[model samples]
Target: MIRFFTTIGGFLLGSLLITLLLIFALNPSFLAKQVLSYGAKSFGVPSTNKVDKFLDQTIIDGAIDSPLALTYLGLDSLNFLTGHKSKLGDYSLEKSESDYEENLKQLNYLSRFNQNDMPEGNYNLQIKRFSLDNDIRGYESFRYHSSPVTQFFGAHLSLVEFLTDQHKVNNERDIQFYFDRINEVPRVIDEIIGFLDKRAESGIYSPEFVYIKAMGQIDTLSTGRIEEHPLYETLEKKIDEINLSKNKRENYLGDTKDLIREVFIPAYRRLFNTLESQSKNAREMVGVWGLPNGNDYYKHRLRIYTTTDYSADEIHNIGLKMVSEIQNEIRSILESEGYDISRPLPELYEVLNSEERFYYEDSDEGREQILADYTKIQNEAMKKMPDYFNELPKSEVIVKRVPVYSEQSAAGGYYQSPALDGSRPGVFYANLYDIRATKKFGMPALSFHEAIPGHHFQNALNIENSTQTLWKKFGYGTSAYGEGWALYAERLAIEIGLVEDPYELIGSLQSELFRAVRLVIDTGMHSKEWTRERAIDYMIKNVGSEESEAISEVERYIVWPGQACAYMIGRIKIMELREKARNELGDDFDIKDFHSAVLMNGSLPLTVLESVIEDYIAESKT
Candidate 1:
């Protein structure tokens, strides 16, 4: 959910940079562009320097441009930058263009330094330089091929979540900041509406599915009464919990209600109207293949997500092969357990899901038990990590049920990283809306994947690490590394004896099979030209997923493009490298050491990761 925090920085005048950061709260762009394209000689600071002050300045300056990012990263509390907490961020097309140009200049600025001459010890420099070299590809080749208000990442919907979840209202200043940000909604909405219209004018309309989902979400925002709305009600509840007097609380509520009526509601309505107007012209286009030069865009997204240049057909073939191998393995296990091998996958899943022993009751108590079980599983997983990981993250992880309101749209499970400053622990959300997704047998692997030994562990390590710069902790393409790490964690549990039960082992395999299936589904929709229904049907028949789960997963792949492929591709690379190290080291090979080398550096492209592994092996041999 975190956007990439670019640092347009170099070692230079500290006073000038500090002045720019202070002024950025009011006009971030002009000074930001100046800071980004500043004197080139400053970048000549030794590349081997682990504590690159220039790079730190770049991240801080770039982050200053995005007010919402500060709140997410917990940097809003910093004394020098607190003025931005009240502001929303720029979503104007002009800003997008400026960002694209800034990236180009950043690349040029990076070229002034000596990438090849960089110290072997400073992997951060290598990773950042490598990332910047590729950051502009997606922006340059397919800028108009994507939209902000889509089914997955709609700005209108995100605005609500950001305010309710991220915007902390602690004192009088924060309370006013909350209302002040609300006051900026109309401007933000106007920019989004304008961007949508402008994109549509260029034949870049979102598909029927995208706009329809967005309009429905907007309806949720626009249709509710002012007081009953989640935004207002949440504020009322928060205000009540705090030490404010009754009169002050009433005034607060009154001010918020007035803002909702005059500013928030009308802005959402305008957004809704725009989406409705656009939906009429929306094509049934499901894939990027429908856009102008879409095949190239899909390839670019593949590079962006997977960090590998594997073509669509190659990925499709890999998915096919993996599906066959995994299904055979699943059949072998079922046969050993005396289950009928002749039955279909969906029927097998039905039998498994129907076991009342695996599920809780359909009541509030059942929901609470499910959450408790998840928490138990997470706690257990965290305990075993010290033997495997050399550096255990101090930050803890907690399991929480998805809020009833947003659970409808939530995935089965996901991890939110800890705050960069360690003020917040990582969170793993289990959506109990669908009880089938919370099957007891799957808890271990799911817990391992979403919490301990997965996202929380890896992300917390990145956030807590003293050596890595801010960009490494919060950069783009971390998802490629992260999703892979989480997926790999599912299998890692089996090796570490976390999945000792026979059924739980099947659960682990099933989780992997789901990712393997994703590889095929993603490539099928984008490259093989499979319709949405075809992809959903394939999953239902192959993985025995419920139709609803299959539909949601397929829709996610449609919107995200090549992201689903990252899990398997990255795991394959990591596994391949591990095997190479193991074979070379033989008796000397240590799983703990191998893991340290992988996790110690911040997330990297698979290719760069392979380089890191090679260096580790060579060092070990010496």
Candidate 2:
């Protein structure tokens, strides 16, 4: 009887072990393959064992939440919720550090990986990954923790601000999300305050002016009667828009009102208290140059933004040279129009501004007309694209006004990312806040920069790339490459004869000159101890932008540091590489093929881009 029972137990144990082995053998490799397949699906590329190994290592390295990676994966919303909450001046240093460490590990892994054994396409993807990791790590070492500029700026005009402005009031779920976010604001504010406090202790506080400007925005956002609060308006409107049962709707409305009464007002009050406290202690200096190791911080910013080791002095010198060259070109154009060459550049800008032919008045009709004209311009430009680009974006493009409330602080124009599913069109937001700023003369080049063959082209192509991972499709595109491509696109328009009018040509040159000035002024304020006034003044003298515009641009450079330098530096590298290809391939070189080579990979660091182009040149030659 004892032997019979022992035999039965042994049989059961052996069967269980065999089952476990089968599960391990069948599922483990399949799980690994699924993970690789998911990455491949995200990038619209095919799966391979090499990609599987890379994906496995990515999971092991734990950089799934890196900002660039998250952006690339169409998981920006998730990343924002987890890593960045929507609150004025709120940022989390602890999270940033964690992200940094993970990114560094991933980068190190990529660096050590055997790239020689990988396919060139896979290696290209790896290079982009490394570039993104390097950029994030560079920012981590700099003044990234010093202030929350995006939040501070967004507090003035962001999606939330837009919702508020639209008076979105009716949906119960909408109200709840509103109140939920509102209740969360104070906690977010506390986190931000904690970050600022640490920076202050380390002598890394923002200029007093920034806090003053921020406080004004806060007051503007929160000053209305409680019922009239922007937050309340947004809750009310959004709630009304959603279809729900009457009973559920009423209950949600009541709960939302109660939450607003009990939670939101107090959250704003807490945020106000924090900002008011910081305002008192804020320093007067307007630039990061005041901080310890500030110069080094600025230099690091330049390197990261430009993806180059060019010094502030080198950029500054380049700006001076370009200013003279652009001026000469402008003079030649003005002379062709019978204007005196001896006249100042500012005078040319003045003439351009005052001419009735150059502007539409600030009326709704005028705005519509401008939009129509921009559309017309884009249509005309699209007809000429085969002259340059071999490939085009699958996504459609539209021109729209920057929403009224946010237009004040928004740039002249910006491209909204296309939907991952391609349900929505890529939008080029033209800031018509000050119609004069959107002068008619600037439309052609501006259209080229923001719409057709500019951001819309490059960014949409990235999203539509079927040969890359969702991460590669969305992730590793750098600002230098992206913005540089747009800036270069502006030049491409000139090359394609899109800018027919000399004034339009001047506008193109002016835009290029603006980027050149940024290279100088960004480096100057951050690395050379140039004051805000000096940077602004230099811009006015050289770039011919309005004083107000110049000041805003200068202030942006102060907070953003190296980002401004990406445009020209990136454009120069691309143009240089194209010229190299043009020279090497000579009769064999196809302009369309050259463009395809540059843009087909989406955005890459200048160094990686050079390699891709070199390969293209070699392949084309053969």
Candidate 3:
């Protein structure tokens, strides 16, 4: 009887093992999850213990399904494990719809787990819920005139930039992956063209001006020779660093050139032709106000970007009020400096802008100096962190210039977070495309906003925090939460004595003023049907921005509705919360604690943020 029992146990165990092997073979994602779990455990992240398993599995599946998201997260192994050896994911509309449904499915599965049962569940739940809700809403509701290509910052521009900057090329395998992506560019372009054609068929189109810019951008890409192309040149630069033989190097270069010329350039030329022909049907009107159900669309945008229920008129009024107060403060500062306050602000800006001392030389040396000064500003802000921040990011933030190709359309400066593995530091890309246009006074505040105690602090902390799940760390937060904190950091620098010079102080105020003007102009164009010129004029008259700068900003607003409004709206809420905390806690209020409370839970909606602050206040009172 004992021998018979032993034989049965052995048979059952072998059968179970074989079944699991078959499952792993059939479902690669299951095997991928097991591999990811081991990797996560090596990094001290728990995957099998509790609710975190849900998060780890979600991130694994998400990265496998989306190549761009995968690249941004610095995860490459899963792409190969999932049989996507050399290509990004499909960009077709059918793929997009299927992905949307999959997200909804995951969301449903996630909702079944009770968030209250876990230690850090609320933060994870809120971030995931907010992300999924917004994506679903945008995908389902906002498809009328939405095309895949945008002259300013869509897949067309961002993909090439991503390949150059974010995609790693460390070894022969990585190089082959790079080649595969480049070779796939034509198919991607064709997919986008299909979407554009669908929009055209639906009587929806990008504005005529968008077509003009898109064609110009495409022309810039097409007219350039393959040898001088950004794609080709970046690969040439990367290949020289690899220790490959001469024959291999030549072959790699040849492959890259063929991909750029035969595959990439022709695809762009095709896009250019498509846009040129489509422009004949495109309207002159720029805003969504002219599109089908435009009002509802604009309202959805306001709610989505600001994460608030505020109306267009109310936001407009808030912008107007803030502008008046900020301008008055500027006037008082100028009066104390013995400048004539009688002249209009724009004329004053013209005079101050002409001063040689206020700007660097329009040369390479001057651009390097701007970067150096920004570093200094970042260092100075770091010195003041102990006073207001209880926790700071472990990662460093480096300053860099925006890529030359996209600099014309890129904003002044933006922050990219460090890799999760700590291989790369966070980068702040300042637009030094036109060195003369870069302002010395503006550099200080920009540094503070984009680097230390701003985006770098908020994002890196969120990414590094072990308490939150993997999804919360990797998931993209709302524009309002991220942008609002950065803007508030600009003001905090002034409070902490970083902006001591009058000019630097003015630069900070001007930054605030710029966001305020965005509130007015963004709403003005999208909701009130203000002409593009009228919006640009409003920015110039109020904020004293240059014509080219105003035009770029207005065009950006035209393409990205309600995004510009988030900064001021978010800043105002953060300020209000701080004041309420201070008022309630009085002498007991700790700035560092207040900041940690705001940041400890990662980004949250304004409504959720208010409740968190109130909870902090109550806990402090006890």
Which residue runs does candidate 3 get wrong by more than 4 Å?
1-21, 37-56, 83-85, 103-131
Query: What ranking of all candidate models by TM-score puts the best one first?
Result: 3, 1, 2
lDDT of 1 by residue, 75-162 (tens): 6644243466778989898998898788777767666667555566555556666666656776676777778886566678778878
Best candidate, TM-score = 3
User: What would the per-residue lDDT of candidate 3 be over residues 1-622, giving only the tens digit for each residue?
Assistant: 4343378778788778878889777887777767766665533345444556776677766776777766776667677466454666577889889878987996897787665765532556655676688778778877755667676776678768878887787888888889888888888889888888888888888888888887887777777778888888888888889878999999999998888888888898998999999999887778889998888889888888899989999998899999999998988888888889999988888877778887888888988888888888888788889878888888899998887777776688899998877777999999887665677887888888899888999888887787655654555467788899999999999998888999889888989999999998888888888999899899888887767777878988998998999999999999999999999999999999889887877678787788789989998999
How far residue 149's Cα lies from its native spot in candidate 1, in Å, is 1.5
**C-alpha lDDT score of every prediction, in listed order:** 0.78, 0.69, 0.81
Best by lDDT: 3
Q: Candidate 1 vs candidate 3: which has greater lDDT?
A: 3
Better of 2 and 3 by lDDT: 3
In angstroms, what RMSD does candidate 2 have relative to the true structure? 6.0
Candidate 2 lDDT over 191-251, as tens digits, reads 6566667766765666766766666555655555655655655565566677777887677
Q: What is the lDDT ranking, best to worst? A: 3, 1, 2
